[model samples]
Target: MKTLIFKTASGYLLPLLVLFSVFILLRGHYLPGGGFVGGLIASIAFVIHSFANGLEETKHLIKMHPGFLMPVGLLLAILAGASPLFIGETFMTGLWFENPVPVIGMVGSALFFDLGVYLVVIGVTLTIIFTISETL
Candidate 1:
């Protein structure tokens, strides 16, 4: 299964998939794609690479344990949701910045929440997949 062509193709596909996933995540607020789908796409990239290059190589490429991302993402999401409380607003309230970012448009708690979801999804998914792969 580890054909040279497959390895090379997977190598190229990993970056492309990750980039596309980010694109999907960023456009999610106004479009169909979002954190969950984006994370799935990104995880699929790593899975494909692992299939071609082996688990160790894929793990090495990622540079860190996927499980670590979970808490960080949770913290981000919680912070985003709780931020409104400081301003005398309800929890999980949507708060928008005065100035919109050039490309992503209006930045807000929702975006941060979505980003948190993105990281959480990626972490959870990769953790599960890698665990299953390891046992096989």
Candidate 2:
């Protein structure tokens, strides 16, 4: 069928797109492409996959319902924000530590916060998209 051909042809593209989304997510703290953009990019990829295959297959590919992404991402963000409180500093303090590994160099609570945001975006986007797609 037409769907089978389309899915097979485009199946290889999903991984590449997801990887690029991750790259954007990681570099976002320093530059323009943060969670919002990265999450959007990832959602787009999933959307493509969903269209090519179907809602159920896309869900199976991720092995999780879209609803799960929001809470976990929220938890990560909250924990990152609360980290400073545990260290006797102000809430959501930007605490930076020099990593022994270069490239990554300095790590901070801000990075974790950013990561949490990234997850939230992905979760919420997927939740909405999948819900809509499933309904139709």
Candidate 3:
């Protein structure tokens, strides 16, 4: 690994993949793609970078352990699902805002739940990959 071509390509690929993942996530509500797919794509980007560069360098680039994301994501999801309860709606009910957000459009609890799923998937995938790589 760490070949010149791979390293060079990965540098460009990382950002592109991340951006595409976000695109997938954002459009998932109406489209086929969703948080799970987006998260997988995002994790693949980092995995490619790790393979091209060293694991240490990839970890450095990430700046924090992936495990930390899990709880935060779970909390966000739980909150999203429970938010409707306070307004006398059922738990996990879809709650939409009056106005759509600029880029994401149609702000709702579903999107937040999807985002939470995205983060959890990314965290779990990265943690497993990193741990396996470290062991090997």
Candidate 4:
């Protein structure tokens, strides 16, 4: 497959899409968006990149195999949800801590879950785009 490099339009649009995805992900906890929606949006960005560039270029952009990351993300998410169980609490219970320092206090399993979702979304998004593009 021929490798296509990023052009000016893609360069500008990619960052915008990624920023939007992050915004959605962050606001998801309270608003209509969430990790899933954010992931989808981010995946769309990659898809756009794949369309603008070629499959080989996209492959080159990925430093590691996306499949490997998926399990890690899943584990993090599971561990997050299961953390409360270890402490004799119910599943998916919220845990909060007071910080001696700034507003950054040790948060509960929810943040971990979000992190897991973030990684999973990124991994899956990359994998889907790479796979489909390669087949073309």
Candidate 5:
């Protein structure tokens, strides 16, 4: 894993990759970008960081196991999708609520889906990192 970190001039690109991944994940519902794309982007960022910094340093950067996050994301996505059913709506139906505190419009299933995507991305990205790091 230490071998994966490659500190060099190219290392600066890591932050940008993470930012882009978030963008992809956020825009998933409105655009083509989604959890899968975002996850790949994030994974690439970390992988690049690992290459630039070294696997050992990269390991320190991660606070938790990325693989475990995958299931959490899946659960969130399922819950989001199924929530409509419990509410007497079709699967994946759109739901919204107005936040009385701020009096803001709150959207439902879309956000839930995004959450699921976020989890999936995190899990997949970690899995990739672990696999590649171990091989190296």
Candidate 6:
């Protein structure tokens, strides 16, 4: 596993996967894709790395426990939902913000919600995968 190919290919592949995952996540709020898809994509990337390396190495690479991810994700989702309350709107009500942001047009509260879902999905998926992989 100390070969150059493993190191080099993983080095290149990880960033590319992250970029693609983010692209899917951002576009998903509006298009067919969304948080679930994006999170799965990101999880796959890490899973690939785990297969290439070892579980302990992958854990070290991630620098965080899988159990910790779920809570953070849940918090994000809750925050996204609660955001509307600050503006005198009902919870989970979609609020639009007409901002001319490049690449990501019309950033809105829905996007925040999507992002929250994205984090939650990634966290849950990774937690499951890693936990099961430990048994295998």
Which residue window of length 10 is worst by lDDT in model 5? Answer: 99-108
TM-score of each: 0.95, 0.87, 0.97, 0.79, 0.79, 0.85
The sequence of per-residue lDDT tens digits that candidate 2 reaches over residues 1-136 is 3377789865987888888888887777778887778888888888888888888888889998767888888898899999889879998888777663466545677678878888888888888988887787
Better model by lDDT, 3 or 6?
A: 3
Q: C-alpha displacement of 47 in model 4, angstroms?
A: 1.1
In model 1, which runs have C-alpha deviations exceeding 4 angstroms? none
lDDT of 6: 0.81
Candidate 3 C-alpha error for residue 82, in Å: 0.8
Count of clashes, each model: 0, 0, 0, 1, 16, 1
Worst 10 residues of 1 by lDDT: 28-37
Worst 10 residues of 6 by lDDT: 1-10
By TM-score, how accurate is candidate 1? 0.95
Alpha carbon lDDT of residue 60, candidate 4? 68
Residue-level lDDT of model 5, residues 52-115, one tens digit each, is: 7767667788767788888898999998888889978999898776652242135557767887
- Please write out the lDDT profile of model 1 over residues 17-74, one tens digit for every residue: 9999999999987789888889899999999999999999999999999999899989
Residue 111 in model 3: lDDT: 87
lDDT of 3: 0.94
lDDT of 4 by residue, 39-83 (tens): 778777767766777656655676678777788989998998888
> Which RMSD values do the candidates have, in order?
1.0, 2.1, 0.8, 3.6, 3.9, 2.2
- Model 4 whole-model lDDT (C-alpha atoms): 0.73
lDDT of each: 0.93, 0.81, 0.94, 0.73, 0.75, 0.81
Candidate 2 TM-score versus the reference? 0.87
Write out the backbone clash pairs for model 4.
Answer: 28-33
Error of 5 at 119 (Å): 1.9
